[model samples]
Target: MEEKKAAALSAEETSAAPSLNNNTAIISSDEETQGWSTQATKRLLWRLDWHIIPFMSLIYLLCFLDRTNIGNARLDNLEQDLGLKGVQYNDCLAVLFPFYIAAEIPSNMMMKRVRPSVWLTFIMVCWSAAMIGQGFVRNYTQLMVTRALLGVFEGGLFPGVNYYITQWYCRHECGFRMALFFSAATLAGAFGGILARGIAEMSGVGGMAAWQWIFVLEGLLSILVSFTAYWFIFDYPGTARFLTEPERSEVQRRLKEDHGHLSNDFDLKYVFQAIKDWKIYIHMLICMAGFCPIYSFSLFLPTIIKNMGYTANNAQLMSVPPYVCACFFTIAASWFADRARQRAVFMLGFQLVGIAGFSMLVATANPSVQYAGTVLAAIGIYPQIPLGLAWNSGNIGGSLKRGTGIAMQVMGGNCGGIIASYVYLSRDGPRFITGHSILIGFVGMAFFLTSFMTIWCRRENARRDALTGSSGPQELTEEQKALERELADDVPWFRFTV
Candidate 1:
């Protein structure tokens, strides 16, 4: 009797009992819940693995392709055609980012209130149409409008998708899924390069420039995919009909267990709450500092590659390696991260990869070594983005809070876009020593931010554990128990794994 009683109060049993009743209840409930968890997880892994990743990836890819295709267009005499010179072209790139940032908070708020399928479809179609319009621009004014509109619509994407994934997957599952979606942006870079090479090579078609063809074709594809996202994409679990009731229950239960909390509705109050949390600002800086160099290169990879003496076609082809490396590394890192349920260490490691890549570029004038450095830079830099995103998402509890938190992250991180535009200009090209140096410095800063954030979180976690006296083989929390019904991880008392 003494042994049984003592065993019952063992940390895991004590914490888990809050959700289940006793020994009998434990067996029965585990039998039922585990069955469903296994089934739902399998179904999600199978059905969503290809469909969701590819679909979400397509949206991001188009966003990236449309936004940065201008860099490729520059090689085709876009500036001369528009009678723009000096800083005018760079300014065009610079101006779009502020508007993009301004639009994020509102766009995310609206996306949460409205149905995601409806909102995202509308945004996707709008951006696609805008990209097509970009092809027809005769001067700077027309280009500016198109770019701004692109910014407005694309701004919704990051936050909207971030919110959507939290609804579908458990906390641990989120890192890989987010990485999968992010890698699509990398794929877009690869595809955009190949397409640019082909279109630019054939620029004389119907007297249209290669750059014009690049915009027209990519835009048309996005418009077509927009309709597809509308038909295929599922909203939140409650709104997802393809899954059975049991599957739905399992998804909700797992998600509830994974995080320490969950909430319905897009409450405006959480936005203020999220803002008050200094952690939000630190996360913002983490994103902004890390991404400055990343966005710079995303916009200017073709130009950078051009310096290697690759032909326009060859330069476009060269763009593929970096993006492909980015995609592969991102997938590998995210996979391991989700499996281990870790985030910070992975982010730190990747940032170091970026620092090394950029450092090599800054130090070496040899095109071959520099080219290898670009690939490493892309690998290290691109994967950490989704890691940081998933890490932040895990910490923020309510759906409304998550939405607002992500909106802030996206808006803050993308300020790098503007900084990048200014940092890399036409004259700075070929060997942008200044640009590479700036990237190295920013990546180093990002590493510091991530380290500090991790230490801060660990200390807070220890304090909470000590207060509760529940630290055992399994880390348990009252909030976590409540969260299981409200949020779920693979284990009981799974606090945010940041």
Candidate 2:
């Protein structure tokens, strides 16, 4: 009697299956079936980290150093040499982001078509050449041209890499990986100052100023690294050469199980779909709020320290400690965030910490206290970046939607860079009270937006759970499941990570 009922049920499921493909067999085997062990997973991740993280991090470090070294160059008379007056220096800083913003989405789309290694390396090379050209620029217009070109080339890297990393790691595992990759910028902050200080001694070499040497050296380093990246950087899982067939299959299976299904097919409609999703805008707002402070401080830290009465060399050295602190704190926070599997909670907590740091800056007169506040601000801001990025990337499923969503979020957020350039005016030096106050308000807004997102995601997850009758993937007929997989995160089986 039980056998008969089971047969009937199977027949009914087959009959009701949606017309997709005829392969209706369910894969009920566990990880053991694919020879996936804890040790194997560890070894695979280690291999990925070895190959992927360091290369990506190195690229970002160079990208950041080349982009922001102008702030260091300012101390070496770059502005005077270029005959920049009034808000011209600020305008140069501001101009980068408009082109940067405009290029990001299109660049990401191109990256998907051209492949990551080729696209990423191509951009790196272009930006490096632009960076080198800055050293030869004799006038403000020439400098602006180089800066604009640099922006266009560099804009795609961060979001493109962010999306690429998500393709390899599970949702829960991405936070720390992102932290490891992003910590390069903080490390760059620490090392770039020391590097800039040392390079300043090359003044009058090759008939160029110290600032010129700074750009030349860093740009050369970027170009060298780009050559290496061209040879070393792997494409997506399907094309990766290092993985065995079994290992590759296991990775694909595991990713699908960890998140929902993904599609590689390019569809412009995904961009519209992502745009209509209100959650994407919420995350973008949080990112924008966060970036305002991060870019403002990173681009101006040396100058800020100099304003505190340190010499240029001493100010460079002083800037190192805060970034060093931020590097360690960012890694630790990401590890904890990944372990706890709680992005929004951690993001809110860190944002509040940053707000406190800004408050200290605004409320204090003592240079020592303000410097301490800088450390706190670095600690708070750097960690939340990876958390927020991973949070949005992990929650958005499907390759096309994730790509477009990440690009949109990054593009929207980078508008803050423009705002940051203008807010920290030359006249606002010594205290920069207006800048600090504005940063505090942005951080506050970030906190509120993050809190709201947390609540909304939780509610959405609960609603999905109620509909599915379980908190996990629902059992559906094989054909129905096949159809659902193509729907990406829109499928009821998919749950948003809060």
Candidate 3:
């Protein structure tokens, strides 16, 4: 019954909706895409998916692995060695987020100035070193310092890659690409466990503990990847070295068609303008709410599982399945979201799944049920991150606003990340009902906000459609159209994706 309903919805959407929605590139099903064919566009995307997504995916995978391995380290007796007691471990976790948040918008601004490849590679190198240094930390203070450094450097990659993906892909195309790129994060969760367990046997190796091996080995791998990834990361569509001149032109032209002449040039006005945009703030709020649970789950899943009566080694093994399940679900959801050409519909529905999951955790004292709840929660939480990211980028126009706004949204989310660190208290014990309940609230708030935005965007798009009054984009004067581009999301032809 659900499948049929979904199919009907898909059919209706395909028929009723314009391909060139608010955040989407200017194209139509019946119209020729400038001189470029739709098949050509798909081929180009295929080319880009091959070239761009892999390295970006790998980079994100490493970032997730480095940052969240602390959870795995706990299972390896890191707390005992470092003497992190009571809330001290939580404090160490929380310390990274402020620096992470602080670095984001500035890092994004610099990334645009220097180009993504250069900036992302530099951050990867710095964070890799920080991750390596984490393994060498003798005490909590040193751990805090290394974590802070890691935060500063690792902060850039997520927002950076998000902005970078927008440079290559169209708005409608972004959801899947972002999801595929983010699949690495789920892989990181799964692999972090596998790696953590595998390295556990080496606890006594070379005068280092298993946690140290996890940190050092993963960090060194990142360093190696950072050096090799630079050449593949590439610049914007206009300057891609792998593309032929025509391909580059087609790419840029397609981007220009979709978004009205997005300029990558660093501009103070655009940054300030993005700060002023209410929609950007709404994006920020949504992200802030969404990431609270996301960070909690990612940073503490291993520990959460360990508390479920599994040994640390068994917890590592068990943790892998939820993440593995989430990876597939995340990718599928994004693909379906893109196909439906709607955001809130899928998002709100899945958020309920997450809410239901967490409700189980809070309601149950049974470890098996609680573990099952975690799976549902993982299924619910992971997809929202990429979908929200793509939706945020899709709604915003132009490069400067995109960069600044995306980073700002992510920064807000990381603030939630900080709050997340303290949610699962030691006193909460096996159930951690407080933490689970908190997650339910935050994720529910995110759902409510997204629903509100859906209504707002739909109303705005209707107003714009009515204003255009059957006179298409071609009927508008060149100057008027250029002004629309300058206005970004406020223009008549540009309709926000609900």
lDDT of 3 at 384: 85
Model 3 lDDT tens row, 145-239? 99999999999889988887877776788899999998898999999999899999998999999989999999999999999876887766655
lDDT of 1 at 248: 56
Given candidate 1, what's the lDDT at residue 293?
77
Give the per-residue lDDT of model 1 (tens digit) for 389-437: 8888777656666678888998889998888887776686678888888
Candidate 2 overall Cα lDDT vs. reference? 0.81
Predicted structure 3, TM vs. truth = 0.92
Q: Per-prediction TM-score, please?
A: 0.88, 0.92, 0.92
Clashes of each: 11, 0, 3
| lDDT (C-alpha, whole model) for all candidates | 0.75, 0.81, 0.82
The TM-score of predicted model 1 comes to: 0.88
Residue 248 deviation, candidate 2, in Å? 2.1
- Residues forming the 10-long window of minimal summed lDDT in candidate 3: 10-19
